[model samples]
Target: MRLLIVEDEADLASALRTGLSHAGYAVDTAATGAEALAKFGVHAYDLVVLDLNLPDGDGLLLCRRIRSVSGVRILMLTARASLADRVRGLDHGADDYLVKPFALAELLARLRALLRRDGDTGEPVLRAGGLELDPASGEVSRGGVPITLTRKEFGVLRYLMSRPGRLIPAEELLEHVWDEFANPFTETVRVTVGTLRRKVSSPGGTPPIETVIGRGYRLVDR
Candidate 1:
């Protein structure tokens, strides 16, 4: 999943980014409200890890702004532990709230819990033909045979399998599965998809993933 983390503490922001990336998420961060808005405008994020204090503005205001524009999940992090503060955070549209000095494991677990219970964004197991994927466990198998995959490969395949027969452009995949720093001009998406196809397909007649010349790709279950 793609995420945006709005935080002003350099160490904290960097640590969150590193941890989330290691957890197989495409994460981009902003240290101030202005920077966060700019990134928010350009990217589609599954969630936002927002700090209550910002250099430019109140995080609650930013939270309301983001909530007004999108239904993306927002997890507000703050030093304030008062019950009133938590109520305010939720009223301002945060889906979840976490206090500072929390453990990294707890943060990850809370984030997972938020998405797990979400009706719209829940991570459901995806299956197409003999291929089976467990998003929660990061497991992929074809015809009951396990398939090993890199993080990117898993993300790409998960996305493709989610939509089934819909055509997905390479740009869309790059935007959603890769971070903002990914070079759009490079052959990264194509190369990664090619490698993923080879891994998932048996040495046989045809790969289930189809390339329609200039159009993009569609995964066909056989």
Candidate 2:
């Protein structure tokens, strides 16, 4: 998963970024609220680790602004442990809050919980670049236009859209969606992804599923 860390303390930010990256997450760092806001505008991140004590403005404000625009999961970090402060953060749209000087394991556990439960209302759409999918109705669309999809096509597109830009292997895909009993063959992945690409990609356009030479396919957000 891709995550953004917004904290003013240089040491803490670097340490958290390193640890999270080691734990198999793509990490981005922002030392201030402005930087966090700017990064939010550009990239689609799975989660945001926000520290309340930012250089420019309060982290709560940045969280509110982000909640206004996107469905990104947010976990607030603060030194303040008062009930009032926690309540305020939650009321302001934080999915979860962690007190400072926290154990890395605890923080990671809370972050996982937040990511699992956080959901956005309004149009149920997962979008990347021009591609879009509606999980509820099993509908696919590109650039605000609707498209038809088979059951497997919808499932593949839904999984890809869930983690935009993340390289998901065919083995993982098969184990999760197809069947755990199914053999981990690369060909199944290639053919499924190929059909998905033809449907989702523009006419004569490069497929969004990037082929890593040794690794698996990644859904390019661009």
Candidate 3:
């Protein structure tokens, strides 16, 4: 998923961007509330890691602005640890809150929880045909056999499974699965999908992902 980190602290923001990117997420950073909003307006982020204090304006107001435009998940990150502060953050449309000096592992866990709650499907494990995907554990299996996938491959499959039986264009996959730094015209999506198809297909079984002429790829029902 994609994330926007709105933290003025250069070091912390850089660290978060690097860590989340390594953890298989497309992440972007903004130092000011204005910058954050500009990026938010352009990108459909799955989540926003917001700070209460900003160089341009209060983060709480920014949170309200973000809520006004989209229902994207918001995780408030600030040094304010008081109960009242947490409550206020939540009241300002933040879906989750995390205090400063928090462990990266804990932040990741909380992010996952928020995303799971946002998944309107209400199902933790996604199933299509003989393929099963557990988003929480990042696990996938086919016909009861384990299958290992690269991070991008997993992201692509997850996006496809999120809307089963629908034709997904290559541009859509590139927009959602890849970060802003990725080239829009790159053949990376095609290459990744090809590899994913081979890995998920069984020797004597029908392929689950099918390509359409000049359209895109679709995940077929088993």
Candidate No. with top lDDT: 3
Q: Which pairs, if any, clash in model 1?
A: none
For model 1, the superposed segments whose C-alpha errors exceed 4 Å read: 116-123
- Ranked by TM-score, the better of candidates 1 and 3 is 3
Best by TM-score: 3
lDDT of 1 by residue, 78-120 (tens): 8989999999999999999999999988888787777666542
User: Please, what is the whole-model Cα lDDT of each candidate in the order they appear?
Assistant: 0.86, 0.74, 0.88
What's the residue-level lDDT of 61 in candidate 1? 98
Candidates 1 and 3: which is better by lDDT? Answer: 3
RMSD value for candidate 2: 12.9
Provide the clash count, candidate 2: 0
Candidate 2 achieves a global lDDT of 0.74
- lDDT, candidate 1, equals 0.86
How many clashes (backbone N, Cα, C below 3 Å) per candidate? 0, 0, 0
Work out how many backbone clashes candidate 3 has: 0
> Any residue pairs clashing in model 2, and if so which?
none
Q: For model 3, where is the 10-residue window of minimal lDDT?
A: 115-124
Give me candidate 3's TM-score against the actual structure: 0.92
